[model samples]
Target chain A: MPRSIPDQSKFAPGLTLQLDADQLHAFFPLLQKGVAVPATVGCTLKCLLCDQFSIPADYVTDRITTIFMDNRPVDDLEHTIIQDGSRVTLSAAMPGLVGATMRRGGFYAALRQGISHVSGGAAAADQHGTVRIKLFNLLLAELGPLVLARGLILEPAELADLLKSIPDRPLDSSPGTSRVLLTVRFNE
Target chain B: MDKIARIDMGAAGGPKVTVGDLGEYAGLGGRAMTSLVVAAEVHPLAHPLGAENKLVISPGMLSGTTGSMTGRLSVGCKSPLTGTIKESNAGGQAAQVLARLGYAAVILEGKPEGDDLYKIVINKDGIQVIVDNSLKLMDNYPLVAKLRQEYGDKAAYMSIGSAGERKLLAASIACTDPELRPTRHCGRGGVGAVMGAKRVKAIILDDAGMKMRPPKDPDAYRDANRKFVEGLRKHPVTGEGLPAYGTNVLTNVLNEAGGYPTNNFKSGQFADSAKLSGETQAALEISRGGSATHGCHRGCVIQCSGIYNDKDGNYVTKQPEYETVWSHGGHCGISNLDTVAKLDYIDDNIGVDTIEMGVTIGVAMDAGLAEFGDDAAAIRLMEEVAKGTPLGRVLGSGAAITGKVFGVERVPVVKDQALPAYDPRAIQGIGVTYATTTQGADHTAGYAIATNILKVGGDVDPLKTEGQIELSRNLQIATAAIDSTGMCLFIAFAIMDQPETFQALLDMLGSFHGITMTGDDVVALGKKVLSAERDFNARAGFTKHHDRLPRFFYNEPIAPHNQTFLMKDEELDEVFNW
Candidate 1:
């Protein structure tokens, strides 16, 4: 809940994303928003930072301090596998001992030997689908706006429920929101 | 500026007070001052609750100054909880006020020889040890309110509650914050038990006539203080994230890393972590007419603490930290934020350590005293502690005693102190600290999380055993030094990442004292403090075998990642070698 946010659609100012029930179902997985990331299950489990996703070179070092795949700390990102449906998470630097202990390929990796992810078996066939992504702490402020503008895969019911919870609070009233511009694009 | 106040509670005629020069304790402050006093003056093998065990209270080196985030007070004693020398520090107005009154430390020696409780008052006028039996068994909130009415709200207060009066091992010393709310606490290892043993209900400090301690070099000190404040403001952790979300922000981050220590350490991940997370808690506080960002003391620039209001938009308690949330919420399988907040208020009011109390409840649940996730049952247990019932006494003795009383074998403890929010099996560097720290399983002793997860100092692989000893060692030393300075520990994030910030802290001290200080001097001070603590523990019969996690941490593999504590005994033994 600390880092949960609806992905905003990018567009001109004063514009909002309004979609019909049928249209909402056709475009995105709105019902599973925040509850689950209904990404493609798995044809194969690939190494996270290797060939699974094309992450920028500096993203691991500069962007993300903590990484998690399938609720397990991905301290060694190059070795940790990301299956199709794996819930992947990224966050900027955090406080306390757990934060230091979870860094990817960090010097203290030896401390977590029993829990370190170890990849096994050959790579699976290439496929296109979805994977759960969560941003937290400083990463939410740094990349949230950009990710929101790019549009997020969400379940419509979750969004509706969120809006109903606090009718007075605007969707754009989070920590670092100067302006909120939204546009809904249908897949079909 | 160089005085120590000694109170002899068991004096032949009656309680008496003596003021003397600092002597051997000239340059010490905070943990260093307290630990050195306990280590030197008190007998190691004496019963912690007996007359021979003394309690030493002192402010940090930079306390009572113009420095940012430097209002922490340290309380040290032979801990009834851990049976080791303990130094617990907290942020409140007491440190600054106590220092301004021109005393380096207040040493309470010997035990009172009666059932009657007393109160001690100190001001510019003199010391007053009053036999006020009317203050018996009062809780922290009402006790402070009564004190405020009698002594005025301008005085800083430190007091005990029913839990402390009952001599419960989980009892904490309550220190009123700037707003005169008894929300800040020295909440570890039962320093309140020792205070209770001394038969003193409260120590009121009135510094109405005192001014801020003058600096030796005013201009240099001002420049250094400005640079230090600027450094904190520029850093992301201190300047933005903490101010926006407070310490509970760690709930989500730890949950994501699979090291959140849920269900009483049976699992690493909690299903309902988000409900008790910092973001949701912040929004709830804001919506309920409470603030999401506030300072515990006057000079705190980071403002990581906040105010939490209840459903009716009335003040309830300070924002619960991540450890409190995890201990009472995720670890017990309770997800309701309101429940956690209410629990926090109850703990603060009754002057109990929230972490110790919550963990005790979790252990009781494991023993079938109540079901896990039973929010009402948890609240009832805390209420019982407030009333000091027979069952409540056992519950208030902390997790180790509760686990033993209930025949629960999965007690997560080292040296009888409860392990905090982090699962050591998942984050092994913390395991090393928990196992080897002189103060038992305290997370703040050496917070490796900064490097392992936050990447502030340097990245350390949390899951591996290599470099763990060194990481815990360096952090323990650095943390000892910082705790001495009375600066908020959160500053380490910025200082570790930015070298100049670290220099600025040293420069502030140097400018204030009119001396040239180098990084080596800080390291030396840290080494001295740790050595004193280690020596105290050693004299108290602690051997290398005492420095170990419970057997279950090695035998049982936590879920999600299915990991066990992998550090070998030999490696753990080498932690304090340097």
Candidate 2:
């Protein structure tokens, strides 16, 4: 009974990115700081300007297929970075859910939820909140018994930490302080 | 040939089912009478997993209908999970066959000896107690095959997986459809484990060529059913939404609404959520070249079934749904659609509760036992559970066991079962349903169907439990009466929203019984069922104290929306008042 919502009620969570493909400079600073900019241009803005606005995970940038904000899935958003200077826009729709009818949002929405979770001290540092902290646990669910068939849970825990320790950052924000935006192209 | 009979195994003649007053309790639509049986026989407080238990499965009021989903049945008993009077409905041909042969609900009285297995098979003959050693250590998949080979697919089957065989409180009772796919289950609550405790491995029912003239008004019945189907087809929620997105359609919607429970009950969100959502599952289907929906039973107008495929479009499984996807995907922390889909395929075919298993695995992972998003491990563990290995036994034990093993105090389970998709902390109305329903923490029990059978006052705010008691009570009642009719609970969805549909149902029932009844009777029937269950629960040892949610929900705050399960205990207790 996950989505057992009552009738005529609308209380959902998501972030809709409304930006102009022509206004890259306008968004660069705010995007770099990873802050939300208010104002909507339109739902489907097919602008004729030969410009590009990159929907980064956090930091501002262009020319990336995915923007990984936390562990939210970003590859599912409709994108085509091939249209030209003509611009290829990709808004990263993210993930965060538990009950039924679970869906995906954008990078900003997932980031907002995670930061909010961490700030509220709901994840307990160790718990990682049910969102990000959960991927580690669910993956363990997929792997624990088999690992136990061979050894213990702590054995894999150490391995996960060791693997996470390998840095892939480009020295921007403090790695622990804020997650770096990844501008990854699926096939470029 | 041996006479088809039974061997009483508990207490004197094994805790006797009070068969007084009424005889021939057989074929009495498993859902309806199952409630009454639990009400009469089981002492509510007598620990759900303890000896003083009675598990009953009855067919619907009208089963065996090439009857669009009329072949459904119900399993009722005191829930070891919620410690409340409980009943779970499922789709299969067994109830139809068993009923066609004239047995209403098969009351499984007392407990069994050891883990030795037995089965109850009914055919042109009668009820036969067979030694079920052939499929003793097998999961539902292989077990179904073996049973079909022996009894033929013409016989409907109901069985449990290693999860149930292990007596996990989260275990579900699996049933086979016309397709022989054991995708349908009387899930939610540890009813299967109860059967497992009864030492029954499977229940094979074969009416073969038996004829059953269900009480129906020829033209009127047809008209009512037609209208019901039409209404289902017309509503956006039932028709387009469910069929298009299937139940997973709500994934993105639920996540957006902040009601989704990401990991256990710690948060109401997921990061890699889209990767495993209904939309994602649908995407996987399109990419992998598979179906997006199918029917749980034949002739289902709302065919929300899907063909989960491997990367190469090879047939993996069917009926990959919102619960399974969420539990394996978000709940277990895996954002991989294909991986979770594979696990769902394996679980469904094997006949396990994916949500329970996923939640259990998630809890285990939370205990630092494993990492989330491990596809190979999930597949391997699911396989082990199917194989009935010792590790599988532990895996099958579910979330409560994982919490116990890890010493995690934030276990969000009521009774002994894992909570479904909604975090009670987020949806306080559901918390009341979890806290008060006879079935422990089951959402389906009181998932109010618009305004169908019973009416409740006020619009219950999702986050608040203001009118939840009256709402839940009315739902519980209407739900019970509906189950007796052998209709899909989704039919309740129609009843809740459309008055005509509800009126049609009553009209059809009246036509069959040749009586004119008003809405007041619906209320009365619902009250009767609730009172019956309450009386049994009270006798069984359930004080007002048992009618409660777990403690951590109140103490902890779930983030994103930052709310806790804040319903007062007095409010919860008020739900049980007749």
Candidate 3:
């Protein structure tokens, strides 16, 4: 059954739904498709992943074996800075020669040197903005819940079909609200 | 595994079989055994489907032993598709069964008289060659089911479908998986045509009452095997990712990296790639009562193969691999997983190489025979091949021939063989391998994709020419060696990452063979295999000119990456330098 979570954060005009584990798990495909998350632009990937998303640093280092920022493989999380409207993809270690090539700081990094993320010096200054984040494979289970609970921004059209399937209306209709803030909590 | 069985189909009254010692071919197995035999015996200039060309089937060195992931069967011949020496391997019970039957290689030679089909059964009793014209034109799935009634499920059956019977250039020889399904195949280079030319429809290998090949140092072999399995199980790629999703797991990552060949290599990424991604495929499979993780062979620990079922929980085919998915799903502009699965089953049943058939269809689509993204047209085209219509004959000949017949300007082939899924323009390391490998544009010949895209061994920039030659060359050498040992190529990921895992592999080989196998010895074996293959190809009129990607790859810039194949011809020539 669908459960609703009380909104405690200052962020207003958002939808907060508490779903069972299975319901939340169904959203993995959406994660792979990518959802927008508000973040401080021009910060290191490590900062966005750990400090902003509140993902454990150890989990980011150990579990997420492949990271892609703007379609380029990210080898160094500490130096590669996030940009506004950038697309970030996270995945567990993949299979095949292609999978190994996408690993962070992997031995075969040179194979994808042309597509590897190159840091543009240091971030000039941090600014409030949003970046798209995508989770794939095992990472969907490991990091998906955390990101969902933290809330993500999505187009109203994108979630319309998904929300229609739910028993309860996830958010009250507000005119001119182009984006919806979706926070998913799992009811054990 | 000490004896070599030779079957001459043109024997005086009937086909005859003779067993002999390995002789000069001692200490060889898998691709090494097949390549060396083809190199030494077969006349290089002979027609691939003629009596002069031989079909050598050999198991890997460690096959039939209590080793993990050692069930690969290598079939080598002069490929009718490319007119080059070829060795294609598949994972199935055939390798383990055939090896346990006291044969290192089963050599089928000489063409039979007209209009007769034969079935050869080998077991502890002896080898029997019987006329079986009744089995003519039967596709693989039904043919195996029929054969099982007589031969029983205890044996492994290797057979070709209608495509092979017609001697189509894209034919493949099917090897039965552990479930007695002919899903695994040595699916390249027209090896099946060679078998069909010999008028042999099926080869039943029954190893009942046979014992495992004994290792010289059993205790050490066991210990090393334990460590090797541990390494594979501990590594995230082998243990978790592969077992969870199979090789189609590559679709999303490759698509995201902008190296995935879509719509006949015109684009690098497919918009509907998520629909065919491993994550989505696996979920759908489970929902339909199919398996997401399955082993093609008994000893496979990685289980990168799976079962695909229809919406109503009926079996369709084994999980379509990454290349199969891309070639049929994205390259042909069809994204539905069910369509891909249906096509995969049809390809397996018809006994054609999926890569070749799909690429041929793509080329045909480019010719205006069918519109892109037309799933019905794709199915109809494949059905035409099965029916052997006039157009089907042209399409079944593979991509290069289809391109020539239809006047499609941008055919993706090398040495007249269709390129696998990865677009060479985006992944340049694979481009070098495609242009230079003895097996035409085969990705597995030297999987630069591992390093270039997957980062399994070491990193090389996929989009640049730098380090690509060395990367391809090194991978080719290493792959040739591993293919000889009968281990699945997936082991390369774990071994390349963990030094102890590599040493464990060496130890397994050394202890089993009663010798000190080192890294240097492995390289030497690989070189020996490559040198023999290259020598055969050269004798068969293949020149450096034959070692090149289709001109379109150099001229056409694919999207997302906006890059063409960057390696110079001179740089490609350096791949075999070592």
Candidate 4:
């Protein structure tokens, strides 16, 4: 049986911020730089994105045109498994030769045959672990709000600059914590 | 689009202008018109800056029509930089304006005596040649501003800056965008030097009263155009990715793929690439009161261009492109967007090719003239080019000369022209293109193909890597065909993926020209253009041996991939076989 991801907020002391739509969009830099999210490792990329992250499979198929796992271009989402400490980057279809070359199962995939992701089989058992997720370009606008609402973990240093900009916002994280669980609520 | 204008700068008692019908070259446009004219008229062995060499300026076949994305203008000549037949095109109002002025092409021949500068003005009435000595040595920004005072905002302008006046080998000819800013450039092969050698500083085109070129079947043309636009809008790359962040969006993806050359091609990845990524650049532009989506011309729907502003919300320059960002940012080990934007402005102001200038600076850094990440030093070097200093002259001659003078062994160039941002070692496919393209190391040389029409990769085995040769050949041929249409190459992304889009393009062309155009016709046109270019190069003493990357690319391995260019010279020679 697969293990479920824990409710990080229940045990881990963190901060909850209420922001307007603009501030939520401004928070996308954290995603571009990268943020950590806990998930069940050893699952297929489709399961990891759809089952765990709650991103609809149709949206994943349609919107996510480019994907890179640990800097290797990912072609087959079903066979490529998610491992612990994997750094995943998602983007919409990019322009130019290199952009086309990086698309998921694109015709130009032969152009970048050296760095393509050859799937290693899924792990013997599923285990809870952390993976870094990065969103770029159009994906930032599409998936950013959902990922922020679900929650993410950020380094204290990474949040320093953003925290300074939004001083009046509420903070509940303990001082000197190494990492903070951040959840954003958009005011309707 | 019916007649050709010939101006002889060497004619006795000042310059002479003659208008003639396109007798031998009747139905050609864009690259086809330019390449065919240069191949037929100019002597291959003649000095690039001499009287026997001619510069042909032409608009693409669909340029002045109501067709979408047809604003490309081609300028061809014997290259002063590469010593090869060259055709460099750019997007601006020049093509549409020139086409509406009823000129298929403008041929500039013979070199002027003495150092007198001249400007050519054309409107609905006629063409005029006036000696404009005051315009000498002015940069593109101020030169366009000054010209706008008299010509007003209703005309499209083409001019050269100090770099061209000095005949620097990396000089480019600037074309005015819709905003009348001289930001779009026909950059590469030192076409501006050929213009400067003719002593023509600028050309002004006014189509104030001229009507758009009429199509043979207006209803069919309009229907095809609507479907073509829908295809472009529906595609993810053309609709979302490009318009959102522009071409700089490629920086992150290329870096992730370990193909973004850094520190003079020593490595494939840069540590600070995130700082210069398109996401950050677009957000910064928005935060600073500038736009992240803009067009270079009136009919450009892709809107891959943008405006760059300083931290204080003041206009700095147009958004630096992916090549500009890579060449100046990671290639030289500098990672700041502001610095890259500043270098872009200076390069445009001096009317030099950004790819050539940035690569030259990187080679200079490798030669120990300055530290790799020294942003201030890079700006100073560009300023030197503007001032025409001795060191600047050497640098302005391009990477090949810069490497020779500095004794650097690993200069990244082919056929005496600097390579663009993509490192061929990591991406072996582009390496084949860089090695075999007639235009010398240009990335766009094999781009904009309708792959469905060409049936690319169908015959070649997917397991064998030699499929790249077939892919490159078909792309280059189809690219030549598309370049003749004056269509923006971005449309290729939509057309390559959607068959309906490709059919729509054919329908648009067929209806406009009153012919039943097909895929075979496109392929034939592309082959004709490339054959003329190759024939001219062969006559100029180039052999199959010239179709190769620099020796260092094959000898030295780059990091991340730890791969060298694996394609053999024999395999590269197969690219032009078709």
- Ten-residue stretch with the least lDDT total in model 4 chain B: B455-464
Q: How does model 3 fare in lDDT?
A: 0.86
Instruction: Kindly provide the TM-score obtained by chain B of candidate 4 when compared with the true chain B.
Output: 0.99
Among all windows of 10 consecutive residues in model 1 chain B, the one with the lowest summed lDDT is B448-457
List where candidate 3 sits over 4 angstroms from the true fold: A1-12, A164-177, B448-465
Cα lDDT tens digits for candidate 1, B373-404:
99999999888888889889999999999998
What's the lDDT for residue A95 in model 2? 17
Which model is ahead, 3 or 4, in terms of TM-score? Answer: 4
TM-score of 3: 0.95
How do these models rank on DockQ, best leading? 4, 3, 1, 2
> Number of the top candidate by DockQ?
4
Model 2 bad stretches (over 4 Å): A1-188, B1-28, B43-52, B82-84, B110-116, B349-351, B380-391, B457-465
lDDT of each: 0.79, 0.58, 0.86, 0.88
Q: Is candidate 2 or candidate 4 better by DockQ?
A: 4
At residue A29, give the lDDT of candidate 4.
65
What lDDT tens digits, residue by residue, belong to model 3 across residues B1-578? 89999999998898999999999988899999999999999999999999899999999999999999999999999999999999999998999999999889999999888789999999998799999999999999999999999999999999999999999999999999989999999999999888999999999999999999899999999999999999999988889888988888888888888888888888998998988988999999998999999999997899988999999999999999999998999999998999999999999998999999999999998999998899999999999999999999899889999999888898999999999987776667677888999999898987422223223234455444556676778778778888898999988778877778888989999999999997878877888999999999999998888888888888888888688877788888888876
Rate residue A30 of model 3 by lDDT. Answer: 83
What does candidate 2's lDDT look like per residue over B483-561, in tens digits?
6777776665456557887777776666555567566665565566667777776776778887777898888887655
Task: Output the number of the TM-score-best candidate.
Answer: 4
